[model samples]
Each structure stands twice: as structure tokens, then as C-alpha cells.
Target chain A: MASRSPLLAALMRLPPPAPVLMAGSHLLTRLGRKMAGRHPGMIARLGPEAGKRLLLDATDLPALILLQAEPLSLRLFPRRAAAPPSDAQITGNLAAFLAMLHGESDGDALFFSGELSISGDTSAVLALRNALDDAEIDLAAEFAALFRAPETVVRRLAVVAGPRLGLSLTRMEALP
Target chain B: MMELVCPAGTPAALRTAVEAGAHAVYCGFADETNARNFPGLNFSRAEMAEGVAHAHARGAKVLVAINTFPRAGDADLWHRAIDDAAGAGADAVILADMGLLDYARRAQPQLRRHLSVQAAASNADAINFYAREFGVKRVVLPRVLTVAEIDEINREITVETEAFVFGGLCVMAEGRCSLSSWTTGLSPNMNGVCSPASHVSYETTPEGQDARLGGVLIHRTPAGGPAPYPTICKGAFTSPDGAGGRQTGHIFEDPVSLDATFLIPMLQKAGVRALKIEGRQRSRAYVAQVVRTFRAAVEAADRGAEMPVGALAKLTEGQASTTGSYAKIWR
Candidate 1:
């Protein structure tokens, strides 16, 4: 608890509702709703019917995802200080969640090894997990369609500058 | 002929096991009733039925393991599992707890009963008791016994015996130990999981990538090196010594896998009725390769031939393999 630097703590203490922050949140909410309606199967991979709201809390930075079934709502809450009520909650760090989502590591292995956890409404959570496993979901492929222009631009940039950038990032950290 | 009973964590693995010449395949439902209760493993009711049909068509049998202890108020779930197994046309149901066994005996005596190793029925007396009391037809002997002890048990009991010959080794008596329970509030007996991945963590630190179980450091390897899962028993720990110092090592058991293929002939001669392979949580490809290698090994052993060169070393991925308690020492 004491390890965090004073500067970082002071930054965290700043108020939440900045103009840029509100604009970013509004954009994200629209994106989430668009994705929900366009690709309902992605969220349904959790279950055909979400009997109760599921909260996916990325405990690292307090990002949250609320899932609802009736009208199919998927909302993202960033830097939430308080958790909302949920039927089931899956808790993990950003990297662990990404590893599971990207299939870089086996979800079951991660669950068994404690990298991820689900508490509350086990049956619903199991449904979600099984659906995800069966879905073979590739977020990268999904986003490639949504961000095709950006992806191509990034590719062009990478072709021109990948070596230099890669070299810099590769040795950014040094061993103590 | 000694039957080679293999594990199938998934339906595809079950089919692969049967195709690879497994005499019988054991699996569990995708729930807490079975030991391999991970996120994406085990069978559904429809899948279990499908698996049974697949195995039966191939002249192989399917055994369902509902081996975890029944919870205080949720015994009905365990009971329904036995009923479901019977409904799925399972050849037999592997069980552990005495209460659950009795429930199965009363509810579905028609279903054949094999005692799971989770019962820790290591001796003839305990094995005989389960046989006499609950009509257990076969006892999957615990890993703690030697071939001679197994032979003695076979001589004393009327039931058949199955011994695990390959895959992960249980450091402590599986169901009897609560090391994981103390650490994670979960154990094989109640939750049908051990050193559950839900409480496991792997983090890349300045030192290297380290594996921890329930927040306790298990093993730390250099960056980009292999980091083993910190199953509590296999984790390295330090203890106080008499000379005002600390002794740091794998205090319980080293991270070694059990590969008893070389003892096939000795085990057969010792009156073992079946050779079991562990790892129901493995892949179908892994299941196929191990099952094929062991199937050939079991056949060669039956014909009095020497053990073949191991092709399953790829499955272990460089971990040391041992014959475990089967290799008796003359101290």
C-alpha cells in the first residue's frame, strides 16, 4: 500500500468528471452499444439468456463490464471506485484477462492456476466460460473489421518504422 | 488381459482414447462432482451419452468419476449425477465417499461401482470393507502403495484393482490431505480440485517469472524460462534448521511426473487388473499420443517383451519421470 509514489497517489485523488473524461466515456458507451447490437453472439457466448447482470471487474485499474440480457446491454465502466451489485463477478488483472480473451493461455488452465476467478452465480459463470471456450473468439479479428483504416495506417507506419520502435521498446527496461 | 483404463477430460479425448486402444476410459461431468472440475473440461449430459455411444461402438467401456465428497446439503446433486451416469449407459461409476457410495448402492444398484483412489483405500481391509459394504467391484488403488503391497491386497480382496501408471503424481494422499484446503478453501474431496488454478498466479518480476499458489511463492525461474505451476505440495519452501539457518528446497516432493510404463510386466505379474493413465485435463492430441504409446507398451508387456523406448517424453516436456513407489529399495 505504501509502495505507490506520492505523485501517482495525488494523480489518483483528482476528480473524475473532467470534460475530456466525459467525452471519452460517452464515446465508449456508444461503441459498446453498437458492438452489442451488431454482434450479440459475442456476448451471448456467455449464455443464451443472462438471468442476472454479470460484472467483469479488472481489479488492476478498477475497469468494469456490466452484462445484461433482456435488451442485450453491455456497458463498460472505467476507473470505477465502487462495484455495482452483480449476480456473478469475474476478477482478474488486465494482462490475465487479455491472456484469456486472446486465447494466448488456456482459460481452464488460468482458472485452475488462480490467474482468474469467478465468485457468485457459479452456474451462470460456467455458462459464460463454456460459451467463450466454444466461441473461439478472436477480439483482434473482430476489431480488425471495426478499425480497418487504423489497422492499415498502423501497418504502413510499422513497415516504415517498426524496426526502430521495436528496438526501443525491446530494451526499454534494464535489469537491476 | 490387463485393461488399460485411460482418462478423457473432453469428449474428443474420449473418442481418441477408444480409438487408441484403451480398454476403458474414465471421465466426469463438467461440475464439482468430479475431480477435474476445471472451467472448460469434462462432459455434459448429452456429451456423456455421446461419449458412451462412441466408446461402446468401439468395444470399449466408459466410467464416470463422481468422486468428490458430497457437500453437507448438496448430496442430492451427487445422487442425481449417479442417476445421470446410469441414464447415459455408463459401464460403471467411480466413487469415493462412503455416503455417496451407499446412496448409489440403494438408488442404482444396477450400475457397476468402482472405488476411486480418492477414497485412499490402500489396504486390503479397507478395500474389502468397501466391497462388502457398498458392493464395489473394483478399487483404484491409491498411489502410495508398492507393487508388493498391491499384490498382497489383491490376494486378500475379492474386488479388481486399477493402478495409475502415468501422468501427474499426487504428493500426498489425495482426498485425505487438506494442504490446498487450508490455503484456498478448496480441496479435491469437497470441490474435486487440487491446487486449483483459481488461486494460482504467475507474475513476471524483476527477478524473473514466478509462480505462486494462494499467494505463497512456489518457484521462480529466469525471464523467458519455464515456470512450473506452484501446486502446494510441489512448491519449493524454506524451513528452519538446528544450526540457526534455513533449509530451502522442495520440502514435500520434487516436481516429477509418474511414468510407470517400465513396470508394466512387474505390475501385471503382481496381479494388477488394470493400468490407469491420469490427466483428464489434457488435450485430445496429448491423450492420443500417451494412450498409443502406453497401449503398445501394455501389449508388449503382456507378451513378455522388454519395455520400448519412450516416445511420450514429449508429453512430459522435460520433467523427470519416476516409477514412484513401485520401485522398492533395500535399505
Candidate 2:
């Protein structure tokens, strides 16, 4: 029930022109490649499912992301533009996507709660979710490890910023 | 006191459910030996052993589900599941197939046995037969029974009775429905999947979205409306109206999931020993939230306090719920 952080609000309101989207797409593609390198088991587990192009529509943001696991790529497009063809799609807010990526929230819970919606190939979407779950992709930790920053600093930043932004940024560990 | 039996689709969910105060958590192997054979779900053999250790360390029990019927020529897979569950130190094995029950009784006589709802034992005679023949210690009563009928069955049967208090409601008698098989060529009994996601697709239409199962148009929802999972039983069907025109609506049942939290007191009074929550195909978050909610409700029921109602509205399918056959509203 916390308000959206000013930084997130500003990002949401920012106009996503063609150049900006193209640049974001390039950056995401690089990030995706880096993650694929870090989590080889996740891609291997996906099998042929890694080839499917999954459209992730973040309703609270100004862009949509089309992701593919094999040969890792992530392309962003302006929200108002016509959607590209994809094998599956998941639609949700930015917070839901972030939380799911960080393992802080359950993907099935978000779907059941109507906070997220899925269309097209459900099996592929399920494969992606399972692959992600098995990988335990902690976004903050991954970024810190990738950039050689202090893990504690990154984790502490996520813990501090997550609630203020009404999002789950840190990975939720198993209950003791 | 009624024990809380929750579902755990994965090792993470098993730990979460146990931490959430579940007395016992039921799960299946990552195969068709049990029901809920969904993609990227269930536990591996090593994971099962670790999960059992985790639950036992936390003062909880793990019930391995070997409920699916064995294939005509492939009984070894089912037998291996039973053996693996016992090897993992599970507290009990829930069995539906008579052959599996016979095998478990003979092979691992020390392993406790529970009758699965998939067996659809709604009457005392069936319950007693399983107990007498298989030494089954408990029975997960089919969702078709009313509380009054449950009380009657409890009076006649010696084994403990477990009833589903939340999650999906099957209109057809469990273990008997062929609707999903007819549509998708898969069944909960054989393939361990109902309306298998591999056979499901969604198409955007001018009016809204059309959900199809096995290329059969099953449900259509308006734009911005909640679209329930494309289960054949809850699908919108067109039938004869008896007046020349056709009637288009849910012929078997609506898209409402079951929520009987308010009926805890009545069920407890009916001699129910355990309360089960469905959805092993769900995420750990779902498992945790539901387990916590039901744990509180069960404790409140034990104290003769009012049970919490409408706390899980958002979790129910179509954002709606019903008591299902528990109230016998259809009759």
C-alpha cells in the first residue's frame, strides 16, 4: 500500500520514443546475455522452450519487452506501438514483474490474484516461470555480481528502495 | 483438533507450507505417478528426500501422493514412486488405485496409507472396504459430500476423514470425469493433467479474448474481465433451450473456486480429522498465504471462535467462491 517512488514515477512518465526504446532494447539484450551466461542451467532446463518469444507487457510502464531465452535477447518497444508477434505473453504491472524476477513474489499467486494475466502458449509461459524459479534469479545480486559492486550494498539498497517503491526488490529467502 | 493438510508443488513450497504452520504437506513426484503433472512443478527424488527432512525437522509431516491410476502395461513407474516416497521417509502415501494400495500394503507394510479423493469414496461402504483391504488410515473424502453426509460416513468408518476446504471444485465425481480427456486427450487420472496447458491457447477477438482447449472454444470473456482457466467443466457451452433457441452458459458449473473456511466449525463437528487445501500446481506464495489463512481459521475453530470469511476472495477463480456441494445448494 506504499506510494510509488518518485524515481519509478518519473521513469513511468518518461516518453519512450523510438531511439530510447532501441537503446533500452540493446541494453536489455546485453543484460539478458549476461544472465544467460550466469545461469546456464536455466537455459538448459528450458530445452526447446527457450526458443519461444515471450511478450511481457508491463502496464505501469511506457514500454513492452519481448524476451527469448535461447541466444538470449530482450527487445523493448513503445507501449503505443503495435505489438510484435510472439509465442506467449504475460501482462502485469512493473512491480509484479520486478517482484517475480527477484523471487520475492509468486508468479502463480500474481496470476490467481488477477494482478497479472497470461495469453497464448501457457506451457511456454510455465516453462519460463519454472526455469526462472530453478535459476533463483536475484536481480539485485546478479547486478552486483556482474558489476563487481558490494553485494551487501546492492542488497541493502534493494531492501531500502523496494518497499518505498511499492515493489519487492530483494530476493525472498526460505523461511527459517 | 483438525489437522491442516496443505499442498506443496515444489521443495520451496513444502518448506513454506511447513513454516506457515501446516501440520502436514502433501506433494507428488515430478511425474505422472500422481496428479498435478504440470510443467516445471513437483519435486525431484533428491528434492523429496530433502523436503521430507526439512518438514520432519520442523515438526511437520510429508504425505506423498501416488494417486494416479497405473497405466495398463506401465505399473513399474507407479511402483517406483511408492518406493521412492517410502525411501524419502514420507509419513504417508495417498493411494487411489487398488493395485497400488495392494502393492504398498505388501511391499512397505510399515508405510502408512491414506485414500485419495481420486478414489471418489463418498460412502461408508467404499471407505470401509479400503480400510479393510488396504489398511488405509485416512480418507480424503470426495468434494461431492455434504457436511451431513460426512457426519454419517464418519459414524460408520473407523479411519480419519479429510475434506477439502478451499481451491478448485470439480463438478463431475472425482476419478470418473472424462470431459478433459475427451477434449485434450489427457486426464487427471491417467496423465495427471486436466485441460493440459499444452493444448490451451488464447486468441484476441474484437469483443474480447477467446480461450480454447484442444482447439475447442471453451470460454470467452469481455475486455478487461477476469478470464478463468480454460477448464472444460467450467467452459461456456451452448445447449438446447427446449424452446427452439439455444442457451449459452456454463452447463456443468460456473467458474467459482471453492472456499469453505466458514464451514470449519461444522466440519470439525462432523468428525473431520484433517482439512485439505488443493492447488499443488500453484506457487509457494499461494501455498504460504493459504496455509497461514487456514491455520488461523483452524485454530479459531478449535477455540469455538468465529472463522474468518471472505479473506481469500482475490485468490479464488474468477474472483468468486462457493461452498460447492458442502451446502447441497444444487439439490
Among these predictions, the greatest DockQ belongs to: 2
Cα lDDT over the full model 1 = 0.72
Residue A32 lDDT in candidate 1: 51
lDDT of 1 at A104: 36
Taken over the whole model, the C-alpha lDDT of each candidate is 0.72, 0.86
Residues B200-260, model 1: lDDT tens digits = 6555467655666678777665643433445777777778987999987777877677898
Model 1 residue B189 CA deviation (Å) reads: 0.9
Question: Which window of 10 residues has the lowest lDDT sum in candidate 1 chain B?
Answer: B221-230
Tens-place lDDT per residue, model 2, B170-282, is 88998899988998888879889988889988876778778899999998877667667779888898889999999999888888899999999999999999999998877
What docking tier does model 1 reach?
incorrect
What stretches of model 2 exceed 4 Å from their correct place?
A3-10, A13-48, A78-84, A102-115, A133-137, A172-176, B243-246
Q: Write out the backbone clash pairs for model 2.
A: none
Off by over 4 Å in 1: A1-176
For every prediction, compared with the true complex, DockQ reads 0.06, 0.48
For model 2, how does the per-residue alpha-carbon lDDT over A1-176 read when each residue is reduced to its tens digit?
A: 27797887888977688898899898788777777888876776576688899999988889889999876889997778789999999988888887777656667557656577788988889878877765667777777877789978898888788788898776756311
